[model samples]
Target: MSKSRIFLFLMLCFIGGVALRSLVFIGSFYLWFLFGVLTIAVFSFSRNRTALLYAALIAVTIAGALWYGRFVPEHLALERFVGQEAAREGSIVKDPEFKNTTQRLVVSFPEAPSERVLVVARRYPEFGYGDIVRVSGTLEKPEPFDGFNYSAYLAKDSVYFTVSFANVALVKEGSGFARGLFALKRKFEENINAALSSPQSAFANGVLLGDTSGISKELNDAFIATGMSHITALSGYNITVMLIFTHLLLAQLLLPRTVVFWASVGIVAAFVVMTGASPSVVRAALMGLALLLARHLGREGSVLHILVFAACAMIVVNPRILAFDVGFQLSFLAVLGLAYIAPWLEAKLKRIPEAFKLKESFVATVSAQAAVLPLLLYQFHQVSLIAPLTNVLVLPLMPFVMLFGFAVGALGFVSYHAALAVAYPLWLALSYQLGVIHYFSQFSYAQIAF
Candidate 1:
């Protein structure tokens, strides 16, 4: 078999194993028995290269299952503490996620360092990442609701239990690289709020940093109704847009492709860090970098392979994400659509105007939306009827929105007045975008819930 095919086949087997183990429990004994069977089959098929390859695939699949099983014990360990009232000390592992009047913190206990417990605390008396806090509350496992497997979703991050209304006391303030990153993010958020009003500032923060904590429920629903929430999710779509915009703008200055590539890489890396390197953003940034490398090598045809390789690489690191992380799944599907489905869409869209590359952008938007539509329906059970039109209208402006948003945010670090000066144009762009979203969302059939 060709090397590329061999690589793809093996990856698919591994992914299959992970997915299987995620959906169905496979005990260690059964896994080992299957491995031994595959071993014998491998020896039996040694006379035929193709047969040997098939046997090797089965072995890799079993290995993948075993890999996932290795983490099952960690999850089980966390489950044991559920329904118990305990006082535990651990550091806040990530920045607090605020929603309405409460903030959610992922706390890692020293006794069970491998697992995470979600702490729901009041928005007041805020806590930052890496703070050692003593939490006293009843531990509870996340329960599935409304057909959503909340437990599986949290499992993607190794979080199995939750502590609601916890009495959390700060034992020590966090000081480290992660704490610094969170502090920097907070400063940028403050600057954004200082420069713009409520919804606009919230929108800027959402699109720029994937921080939607400030976006009100009404405006957020409008975004959802218009199928524009992905713009704020910091998925591959946003990162890809930033990379392409940077590459093209820099290319216009007649810079070397190599210089443009590295410069773009630097910008993306900084953006990822500025966004606090959340898993979704990190995943998207990695894919963006892979795309840049592929383009630099003039190997665009190999992008699908690169995409699969990137995904499998991530899956290898955290196997549960394959089956549990909705963000990761949607991001992968979006890119897959762009690579495999966008070309056909672009070719068929010849009648559309090419000015400002409208046709190309439309093709990209539609292809990506199409790729993720099924998952959206399955997960959300709601369909945005006007999604295509709204996306085509809004996507063309995202590059500008992101560019100006970043400029204003960076200026805020220097002077609030200086940032405000630039915020006017951003405010105009955001108003126009928001207007489109809310206006379209008012249609009688804008979206339909199943």
Candidate 2:
């Protein structure tokens, strides 16, 4: 076999071995062992010194990855923070204190009273962006529910404690590195809130900016039922949309290649800030950035390889993330399905009419469904029979809906009348689509529960 083919085969074997090891165990050590063995094998088989050097580099990389994974915060430490007294001097690391009937703040302690520290403060604090306060609340570890581990969720995010409302108070303004990120995040939230008025607009903002606070539970349920819930989060679809928009805009401007590259980077960075820089969003942004770099360098990069690299990087940063985070898994697998299976299906279905090339949409939905089906069944215990049809019907209109919805929302922020004129048509279309989803969901056998 050719060297490239051999290399590809080794890579595939390494990935499969890693995946199998992950399922059989709980952490990255086994995967690291597999990686080391594969690296040695690759080096031993290759005749060229350059190839051997590359293999050795890969081995070192995997070794570092394994060490990093081993160093993340312990699960037991996270579990121990439950019902502990809240530290007074804590700073908000995430978005601002948005008030509902109850307010939630995700904060980190600068100097921990205890080594295990992270808290979700649930109280009304005078805390705005960059606010540092002396909270007086007790820390309670999150309780898991319905087979879902809430503690694990917080742990993945590096949160180990939760404070009840009565326990937290504002001390002073927070300073240092994270303050700027939170400031930008707060502004992005304000922009999204100001720009989006209607429910559809709110949903659009959630998809584009990861501001799902405005989306109603009813609408959220409909999205989940119809298998379109990913539309409401900053996922691979949003990343793809941003990349396409950047490429088209740059292409029209006759910009230099370097300038376009930086522009793409800027857009992704802006998007990361706008989306709260969640794990999934960051992963998508990095993957998109890698693809952009490949384009700029005029080298063809495999999406699958880029995806593997991104996943490995994230896992190395926090191995527990793979076990605890559903969003991470869904986002990664969804993108993988689109990157690999969707293209193959599209190629096979290319003979169909261009208008009917809902083939790509169909492939994407099916691919994502295939990846997440077991999880869905395990979590929700129901499978939609109409998902494929629903996706095809709704997919064609998504780009138009997203574009016009954003435009109308932007206009609405400036002028109510003008915004309403643009919004009315967009809402009409979305409402009709929602109606179809609802109608399909109501069918006798629309879904089957295990």
- Per-model TM against the reference: 0.94, 0.72
Winner by lDDT: 1
How do the residues 1-450 of candidate 2 rate in per-residue lDDT, one tens digit apiece? 456555554454444433433334446756567686877788677888767656755665455445544545444443455566645566666655343345566766655523333434454544654567666666676788876677767766666667665456677776655566556565544544554446755666666666676777777777666766656656655565445345545666889888888987886676576445755678767765665665577655456555666666676666655656666666666666555665578788788865532444455556555555566556666677777678667655554565455555445436766766776677776776677766776666766666
- The TM-score of predicted model 1 comes to 0.94
RMSD of each: 2.1, 5.5
Candidate 2 global TM-score = 0.72
True-structure Cα RMSD, model 1: 2.1
- What residue runs in model 1 are displaced by over 4 Å at the alpha carbon? 74-80, 348-363
Candidate 1 lDDT over residue span 201-316, tens digit each: 99988888888888898898898898777777767776766666666677768998899989989888877777687778899878767767877889988887788899889998
Candidate 2 regions off by >4 Å? 1-69, 74-87, 96-99, 111-126, 175-196, 245-266, 276-279, 292-301, 352-380, 401-429
lDDT scores in order: 0.83, 0.60
